[model samples]
Target: MGWLAAGADHEVRLDAGRVVARNRQGRVLRSVPKAVRETEAYLELRQLHEWLVRHETACREQVEQWLVRSLPVPTALIVEVWADEAWRAPLRDLVVMPVDDAGRWDTDRAGLLRDADVDKGLGVVDLDGETGRLTSTQIVLPHPVRLPDLTDLREFATDLGVKQGTRQLFREVWTRPDDADARRRELTRYAAAHYRELRHLQARATAAGYRVQGGTATVKIWEDGVPVVASVWIGEGDPAWETETGPLGFTDPAGGPVRPDDVGPVAWSEGMRMAAALHAGRVIAEDEESA
Candidate 1:
């Protein structure tokens, strides 16, 4: 039988071989008859919940990649994705800019997209601190390019009480430790004593969007218009099934060592983050024993 109304504010369904009753908030009111738990409705609900979890994870990962790479996205694509309930939740209320047909972005056209309408197009709150609908045919998801007038834009956004749906691009970044010795010590503190297999470490680094080369994991970032590369040495394993990691290194585009004080904040933090992640993945002797 289908779900039956047991009370004005409760519902009963056979779920996982049990007859369960729940309130509007999905709180369990009661459960009985273990046989009802295998009902189709119960199984369907469980499957839907699992699918939603995966969908949400996918959405967040995709969006984060765009933010990290500062890649440009098309407005129509955003509108298309917004139609899906699963995608809409993560994308709704994000700051967007309408690109002109000539491939130019005017910060004046930038606004928080409140809603997507089939007939009227996008509802946006513009930079002038005005709320209106924009029917532009095309727009671009701008790269997090540093702008000269960003301070004024931030103040305007603050006045309008705008909260970005995603991480802000070109946000003010912090500086890291200036002392090379101190920075080196901090970076290597998490080095694993036991070697992690080279293949395993490579897989982890690749999955994390880092370049794995010659037994090292490298992350590249731009600092002060200069390219800096941070590398962690995940060495080739020995015949006895052991591998080792060396100290973290930072270098400039010209392959010269960069002092910690010279590294930009974003590069420093990202480089350290990569090192920590690799360290965490190290296969310690204790972990092997526990396994």
Candidate 2:
């Protein structure tokens, strides 16, 4: 059952990617049906994504720079990062769906969320006794990442840039003289747990001839002139988790990693690749008869 479920999930995700790619191609085809080709569609999608990122950031920079001082630094940063993770987690399970469904899987607008066979990954919930409706709450399969809000001292110093206050607060909060040994142990444990995931990603990337920097904690992998994807293993106190540049979110009140499983598939088989596979004129609906 697990095997079938996993494979089905992969196929579903792949199908969803194909659908997105097809829609993208269709847009170009509509505009210039006589001239648009597969190559053009692929190039257009790639360029469009690049343009979107640039425009989004460009428009936000003025606001971000203006609010830099008054903004709730740590909390705002953590929430932004957490939101990113939340968005990606769903697609991770979806990737396995496509592999499971083979050539008969279908997907709707909500992407993998709409797949009927998604119950396992969705995690079972008890039906309400009165209404007979299943619980709407869904727990993340991999432990959710948590982010913590900064204390008043940390926040003031961070936002105000009071040099002495910031230095003193850091010493008192992050590096208390009395608990140095205990803090080391906690930091060590966090690093150890993140090592396995980092190593797996590094190995795959290295075998693909990519140069990897940083270890199991936070890594930056680059394929020379092609592209770079940085997989940062965020921790509760990691400074990197406190900025809009990251893709994580922290719970209100106390910020922390919302979900560790937010890291979706390390593979990039979505969008164009999925569409290319389907464009060979193959149908992708799920088939249960074979099993």
**Candidate achieving the largest lDDT:** 1
User: Against the true structure, whose TM-score is highest?
Assistant: 1
Candidate 1, superposed: residue stretches over 4 Å from native = 1-20, 23-27, 30-34, 143-149, 153-161, 169-291
How many clashing residue pairs appear in each of the predictions shown? 7, 46
lDDT of 2 at 118: 26
Give lDDT tens digits, candidate 1, residues 1-291. Answer: 456555455566655544566766868755532443454555565576577678878987676545444335665666678777666765665556665677566667677677777677778876676888767776544334333355666777677676665555334333366677777687676565345456777777789878987767898775544679988887754434566666777998677998777776667766777877777777656656798
Q: How much is the lDDT of residue 228 in candidate 2?
A: 22
Cα lDDT for residue 178, candidate 1: 64
User: Model 2: per-residue lDDT, tens digit, 159-209?
Assistant: 644343111223212211234454234222212122223344444434433
RMSD of 1: 9.0
